[model samples]
Each structure stands twice: as structure tokens, then as C-alpha cells.
Target chain A: MVGYLLRRIGMAVLVMFVALSVNFAIPRLMPGDPVEQQLAAVSAAGGQTGDMAEAAAAMRARLGLDRPLAVQYLAFLANSIRFDLGVSVASYPQPVAEIVLAGLPWTIGLLGTATLLSFVVGSLLGAMLAWPRAPKLLKFLALPVVVLSAVPYFILGIVLMALLGILWPVLPVAGGYPFGMVPNADFATALGIAKHGVLPGLSIVLASLGTWAVAMRGMVVGVLGEDYIMLAEAKGLSERRIFLAYGVRNALLPQFTQLALKLGLLVSGAILVEVIFAYPGIGYRLYVAIGQKDVFVVQGIVMLLSLSIALAMLLLDLIYPLIDPRVAARSA
Target chain B: MSALAVRGLCVEFASARGIVRAVQNVSFDLAPGERLGLVGESGSGKTTTALSLLSLIRPPGRIASGEILLDGVDIARATPSALRRMRAARIALVPQGAMNALNPVLTCGAQFADLFAAHGAPGGTARIAKLLASVGLGVEVATLYPHQLSGGMKQRVCIALAIALRPAVIVADEPTSALDVIVQKQILKTLLAVQRDIGAAVVLVGHDMGLMAQFAHRIGVMYAGRLVELAFVRDIFATPRHPYTRMLIDSLPGFGARGVFKGIPGLPPSLLTALPGCSFAPRCPRAGPRCTVEMPQTRILEGGGEVRCHDA
Candidate 1:
């Protein structure tokens, strides 16, 4: 077990290293320099201080852009290790790490809850859809689930926004919470945040629920044909036990793997949904950073996304054996 | 009273072609602790008949009309709750393909626990260990998953599970078909030993005639969903009454005999479109004109056996 864990961790570290290198390289490969872009934007906005050459040179020195390429690379690595992601080019003087930290919780709370909710509810629905003993009404739900799964989440988010946020005016249309309300531990604050989250979260859950249900239904159908299922029924186990322990439990293995991968990509994958709602999450920040050419913040967010994906995969590897012993035996 | 009794059991499947009668009027009475083997080629409905004993025939297929009496209760028409109650407690199954017959995620002990718990009985660790031991498996084997065990070992676990509640009847459908020949003998021995211990009548379903000859007290030969002949093991090999049964015996690789293996001439007729006469007429070498126009009546034989043939 220890060996398996160590091997998985090693692989994750290797993946993170490659992702970090790619994150560093992509922004540098972009059309324009961050310092030049920031200066040009400021000048366009009619903000002037001194001569261009002196100001640019001073800015380069402060931002450590004046150093040799190798020195800058090493410094970048060191800073990243310490979670010091330097300053944002668009929002000058604001640390990239601070911005990421601010947005992290909102994205994690929204997308994490959405993913988990979709998996559990959708899987149960799907399992029921395949089960012969489940209600006919649940089986009828398969059609709507298939149609909804095909619809993109952003489109659903926009539709939900127009419906509940505008026509109905029942839900908050934009942002993580009402503007001017300071986020705190109070129940009212938490409730407001959750209320604000309903639209975006609903769109995500509605859109992805179908995929999980369809996949789970397929898996459950296949599992139902297995010899174990037949034996389980023959053993006189209750319909619930056979459906859960024997049928759904076996069918859920691949679904869990898919869930882990989805969670790993959650922050970045929710970009469009976040943008649709004007929600202040990591994905929303990523969108703004890209628009403003804030390279450090973009790189920080990308790096964080990659690191999280690796971590999620690592965690899956560790727990997979616990759920399915065949994996552990094979790895061993 | 018989431990298990089947009368006029008919199972049909609704396929694209038509309703295929998989099992037709298959009746048998299993004495207490008796080992009855149902042997036939693939698609002969032996497995279906075994599953019917547990009321486990799934969709597109169902028991059209029948009575599966276990402890005088009609399993074919039992309520779902009553059926569940009788299952594993009054009748358990040792399924075919033991390699995949167990839930791979659950340990042997947990699977055993489910069988016990489902029946509203406490499955103590000591009882589980004893059950495992009865099937020639060690106590440590209960802690392992199905994938960790070999094919023979998995079948042993399945056997152990079947007898866990000491059900009056145990239906074993080709339990050792996935194992090697050597392992097959060991598994059969383990199965027979366990059945003896529990005093459970077993309906062993398989196509391996040799295994059936050794392990079963009475062997029923099915052809095209009909019980063509059922006789004691010695009588089945000695004076096989039905032409199809005789041909099956002749096709077997006989002891100390050097001859070309003679396979039955043709495939069994499809059950679709209502087979008019004896379903085995096309395949039987001694098929007569009467056999083509009329279904044979099931007749009792002097040797305490039964044969379904007009000439018999």
C-alpha cells in the first residue's frame, strides 16, 4: 500500500512540474509583454507620470522583469513555491496570490457542491432508471435527463438568469453575494451567499445531471446482468440491498473516477458559468485577467488549476483501492 | 414431502421473432438431500429452469404458468416479500461462472454477512468461518475479495454462501464450468460434501455429462426446453430410454473405447412459432412419423425413471 501511494504521489509531482513549466511558458509566448500592455493601457486611460523610457525601466526593475531569463525563471519557481505569485499587471500592486486566495473559496464552494450534488443525485436517478423495480415516473425522467445533459451549462446559466433573476426576480442575478454586504460567519451572510449562488449552481447541476444519470444508468444496466447480481437476488437480499450494495455500488466505480477528474478541473471549467453570473470566483478572475492581459494572475490561476487536478488524481489513486480491492491487488 | 417440486413449469421469452418457450411443462420432485443434475447443450433452458426455482427469470422472459413448491409454498406465484423471505433461507443459489458470481468490491465475509443479514439472521464471524471451512476454504479466505481468489476458490466461496442458511434446496447452475478439469472434481466434491452436511436437495445444472454422472443421484436430460428423459445415474447410462438421451450417451467419450466421437446430427429446433411435436425430432436419429406430428406423452419407466417418447 505504501509503495502504491508513493508511486502515485511521484506521478502527481511529475505532472505538476510539467504543468508549472507549461503555465510559465504559455503567457510568455503570448503576443505582447505584460509590462508594455499595462503601460499602454494606463497611457490610454490618460494616466501619465514621467518619461516612457525611465518609467518602463523602473517598472521592469520593480517587477523583476529586468533580470536575465534564467534568474527570472528561478525566482518565479521560488516565489511560486512560497505562494508569492508577484503583482498583477492589470490591477497593479495587488498580489496575484492574494487575488487567487480571495476567489478560491467561492469557486470551491460553488463548483465543489455542484459537482458532488450532481454526482449523488444524478447517479441515484440513473441507477433507478436502469432498475426494473424503480418507479415508472423515474424511468420517464430518462428522456429529460438526456436532453438536459446535451445542453451546455453556460446556456442554461443564461436561461436561468433570465428566468429566475429577471422575469421572476426571485434569485439574485449576479455576484457571490449582494453588493456592499461584507462576507462573514453570520447565518444571514451565509444564506445570502447561498441564495446568490442558486442560479449558477442550478445551471451547473441541471446541465451535468443528465450525463451522470446516463452514464450511471448504462453502468447499472451492465451490472444488473452480472452473475453477482443474479446471485444477490437468489440470495433473497431485499430489492434495496441488491440495488445498492450489489448493483449501484459496482456501477459507481467509474463514476467516482470521472467525478475526481471533474473536481480537479472544476475551478477552470466553471469559467463560463462564473462569467455568466458575474460571480467572483477563480474562474471569473481568470476571465478578467485574460481580458486585461494580467499574465501573473493568469499563470497563478492556471498553475493552481493544474496542481489541484494532480492532487485530485492523487487522492483518487489512494482511495480507489479502498473502494475496489482489485485495483490494490493489481497495483501491488 | 419433496424438498422442491416443479409442475407444469413454463418459461417464455418475448424475442423479436416471437415468444420462445424456454421451458415447457418441466416437472420434477427433488427428495430431501437428493442431488439432481440437469444436463443439456447450450440454450437448452437448464439454467432458466434453475433460475425459475428462485423466481429469478427477468424481463422479456417470465414464468408463463407453473408452480415451484418449496415447503408447500408456490414460489412461482409468491408475493415479492414472501419470495424474498424464502430466498436464501429456504432456497439459495450457487450460480454458474463463480469467477464473477461474487461482488468484486465486497469481501467474502461481507457477502456472507449480506446473505445472513438479508434473512434476518445474525452472521457471526465464527459462523462465517465455519461455513468457509465446510467448503474447504480457510477462515482467512473470508477476508479476501473475489478477484484475489482463483476460479475454484471463488466457486468454493459461492458454495459456502449457498449453504449459509441451510436452505432446503440449493440450485447450482454450472458452478464449476469455469474451472479446470482437476479443479472441477474438487469443487464438485466440496459441493456434494456441503450439500450432505446441510441436507439440502441440490439441482445441479450443467452440460458436462461426466460430472453429472458422478455427482448426481438422478440426471435429467433436457432437449430443446423439454425434459426428454430423467433417470437414476446408472439407469441413465445403462438403458437410456429416449433416442436423444441414447445419442447423448453415445456421443460421450466412453472409457477404454477407441472410436470417432459421434455428435448428435443437428441443432435443436427453435422454440419460436410453437413447436408442433417433439422438439428433438429433427435431431433424433430414431425420429418417426408420429414423432413429427404429435408431442410424446411423459411415461413412467419400470426402472423408477421417466421418458418422454412415444416408442418408450
Candidate 2:
């Protein structure tokens, strides 16, 4: 077990390095000057009357953008390892670390809850629907699940917003929390935050539940045909018990890898939903940084996101063997 | 009373093409401590009949009609809960390909423990250890997963699991077919010994006439979803009354008779269409016109056996 964990941690470090490098390199390599764009925005608003050239030069030097690419890359890498992300240009005068830290809790609270809820509910429904002797009605029900899963989250998010938000005035339309109610360390504040989080969380669930159901359905179908499941049935286990204990448990292993991928991918993909709802999450912060060319803030947030995914993937890899003894024995 | 008695059992499967008569009017009886061999080629519906006995066929498969009486109680008429109680405790099955039948993610001991727990057996772990040791596996094997074991070892674990509950009857469906020849013999020996020790009736399903002759006290030949012949093991091997049975016995390769064994000619009929007469008539060289016109009645031989052919 120790050996396996060590090996996984080693792989995680390599992955984190690659993720950070790509995150740093992509924005830098993009065509056009981010600083110039920011300057243009400032000048358009008629806020700056100083020499444009000198202002640009000073801004570039202060942000280390004028430094040699190699030196800047090295500095960024070192700063990332130490968690020393610089200040944001978009939200000027704010530290990048503070912005990320503020947003982390919301994303984790919303997405984590959605992921777990969807997995449990979807897997149970799928297992029931995939039984060899299930009625035609059950099979028909699975068809909608497959279709919904195939439809992209953005499309579903929009449809949900239109119908649930606009058509009916029952649910909150946009934003993570109510306006002017900043989250504070208090019971009332926590309760308020949870209440505000419900709508955005529901949107995420509505957008992704279909895919989870479809994937779980296929997994259950495959697991139902396995010999061990037959043996479980032959042992006189009730159909329900066999379905839940043996069938669903074995089927969930395959879904675990997909779940890990989905969680990691959500770090980036959450941007669309975050923007749609104007949720104060990491994704929304990222959007604002990119628009203002806040290089330091972008670098900091990207590194944190990448590091979180890397850590999660590492934990997932290490934990799999506990659920699946075959993997443990093989690794041993 | 016999442990299990099946009379006029038939199973049919509905498919897009048509209804398939997978098992037709199959009848058999197993007395306490009697070993019965159900011999047939692939698709002969032997497995379906076995599954029908337990009322466990998956859809679109259904037991159209049957009377499965266990110890004078009609199992076919039993409620679902009653049937579940009877399974594993009263009648257990050691299915075909036992090597892959174990849960890959569970330790062998844990799998055995699960079997005992399912049946509500007391002292599960200790009982599992005893069962494993009885099947020629060491106690250490309990901690190992299925994938860590060889094919023979896995089969042994399956046997241990099947006998864990000490069910009155154990159905082993082609249990040794997946193992090598030597391992097959060893596993078969272990199975017979276990049966002897427990005094449980065993239903051994296989196509090997020679192996059946050596282990089975009684042999029943199935062809095209119907039983063609049944007799004592020696009688079936020494003098097979049905032509299909004769062909199957003769098809077995003889020792040192290289290149001389003739395979059975013609294919088994598809079960989708209604079977007009004797299901095996099209493939039987000695089939008469009457065999093609009407289904033959099962006739009892003077030596105490049955054959489902007009000529016999």
C-alpha cells in the first residue's frame, strides 16, 4: 500500500508540473498583447491622459511581462510551488490568492454535492432499469436518460434557465447568493449561503444528471451479465439485494474513473455555468482575469485549479485498490 | 421421496424472430445421494432445463409448464419468498465456468462468507474455512482474490462455495469443462468425494460420455431441447437405445484410434419453428417416416430405462 501510494504521488507531481506549465504557456503564447489591450480599455474609458508608450513600458516591467520568457517562466514556476500568486490586474489591488480562496468554497460546496448526489441516484436508477427481465417501460425510461446525457450541459443549462427561471418564477434566476449579503463566519450567514447556493447547485445537477444516468446504466448492463452476479443470484439473494450489493457495487468501479475525469474537467467547464448564473466561483474569476489580461491572477488561479485536480486524481488512484482487490493484488 | 422430481418441464423464450422452444417436456428424478449426468451438445437446452428447475430463467425466457417437486413439495407453485429460501439451503448450483464465477474484487474467504450470509448460515467464517479445506484448498486461500488463483484453484473455491450451505442437491453445470484434462479429472474426483461425504444428490451437466460413464450413476441424453434417452450409466454406455445417443457415444475419440472418430453429421434443428415430430429426426440416420410425422412417445425398456424414439 505504501509503495502504491508513493508511486501515485510521484506521478501526481509530474502531472502537476505539466498542468502548471501548460496553464502558464497557453495565455503567454496567445496572439496580441494583453497589456496593450488593458491600456486600450483604460484609454477608451478616458481615464488615462499620460504618455501611452511610457505607461505601457512601466506596466509591462512591473508585471514582469517585459522580462525574458525563460526568466519569467522560471519565476512563475518557483512562485507557483510556493503558492505565491501575485495580485490581480482586473480586480486591481486584490491578491490573486485571496480571490481563489474566496471562490474555492462555493465551487467545492456546489459541485461536490452535485457529483455525489448524481452518482448515487443515477446508479440506483440505472441498475433498476438495466435488469435482464425489466419491463419495456423501464427500457423506454432509459431512452430519455441517454438522450439527455448526450445533450451538452450548456444547452441543458440554457433550457433549464429558460423554463425554470423565466417560465416559472419559483427558483432563483441567477447568482450564487443574494445581492449585498456577503458570507461571514456565523450560523445565519452559513444558512444564508446554503440557501443561495441551492439554485446554482440545482443547475449543475440538471445539466449533468443525464450523463451520469446513461453511463451508470451501461455499466449496470455490463455487470448484470457477469458470472459473479449470476452466482450471487444462485446463492438465493433477493433480487433487490443482489442488484444493490453485488451488481451496483461491482458496476461502480468502472464509473469511478469517469467520475474522477468529470470532477477534474469541471474545474474548467464550470466557467460556462458560472458565467451563465454569474456565480462568484473560480470559473467566473477566471473569466474576469482573462478579459483584463491579469496575468499574475490567471497564473495563480490556474495553478491552484490544476493542483487540486492533480491531488484529487492521486487520491482516486490510491483509493481504488481499497474498493477493488484485484487492483490491489496486481499492484502487490 | 425423491429429493427433486421434474415432470413434463418445458421452457420457451420469446425473441424478435419467433418463440424458441428451448426445453420441451423434459422429465427427470433425483433420489437422495444419486448422481445424475445430463449430457448434451451445446444449445441442447440442458442448461435451460436446469435453470427452469429453479424458476430462475431470465426474460424473455419462461417456464411454460412444469412440476418441480422437492421432497413432495411443488417448487413450481411456491411463492417467490419460499423459492428464495429453498435456493442455496435446499438446492444450490455450481454453475459452468466456476473459475470466472467468483467476484474478482472480493477475497475468496469474503466471497464464501457472503454465500453463507445469504443463506443465513451460522458461523460463516469457520464454516467457510472448513468448506475450503474439504475442497482441497488451504485456509490461506481464503485471503486471496479470485484473480490470484489458478483455474483449478478457482474451481475448487466454487465447489467449496456450492457445498458451504450443505444443500440437499447440487447442480454442477459443465463444472470441469474449462479446466485442463488433468485438472478436470482432479476436480471431478474432488466433487464426487464431496458429494459422497455430504450424501447429496448431484446433477452433473456435460457432453463428455466417457467422463459421465466414470462418475455418473445415471445418464440422460438431451438433443434439440428434448431428452432422447436415459438409463443407468453402464447401460447407456454399453448399449445406447436411441440413435442420437449411439451417435454421440460413438463420436467420442477412442484411445489410440487416431483419425478414426467420425463426427456426428448434420446440424441440430433450430428451436424457433414449431417442432413437428421427433426433434432429432432430421439428424438421425435411422429416422423413419413416422419419426418425421409425429412425436414419438417415451417407452420404457425391459432393463429399467427410457428412450424417446419409435424404433427403440
The TM-score leader among the candidates is: 1
Which 10 consecutive positions of candidate 2 chain A have the poorest summed lDDT?
Answer: A195-204
RMSD to native, candidate 2: 2.9
TM-score of each: 0.94, 0.92
Candidate 1 Cα deviation (angstroms), residue A234: 1.2
**Clash pairs, model 1 backbone:** none
Candidate 2: residue A104 lDDT (0-100): 80
Q: Give the TM-score, chain B only, in order for the candidates.
A: 0.97, 0.97
Instruction: For each candidate, report its DockQ versus the true two-chain complex.
Output: 0.83, 0.63
TM-score of chain A of each: 0.92, 0.84
**Model 2: residues with Cα > 4 Å off, grouped in runs:** A27-70, A132-171
Q: By DockQ thresholds, what CAPRI class is model 1?
A: high
Candidate 1 stretches greater than 4 Å from native = A28-69, B255-259
Compose the digit string of candidate 1's lDDT tens values, residues A1-332: 88998899999989988887777777678798777777887888999667978888888998788999789888877877898888897888899999999999999999999999999999999999998878888867788888988999999999999999899999999999989998788999999999999999999999999999989999999999999998898888888898889999999999999999999998897899999899999999999999987878988998899989999999999999999899999997
lDDT of 1: 0.90
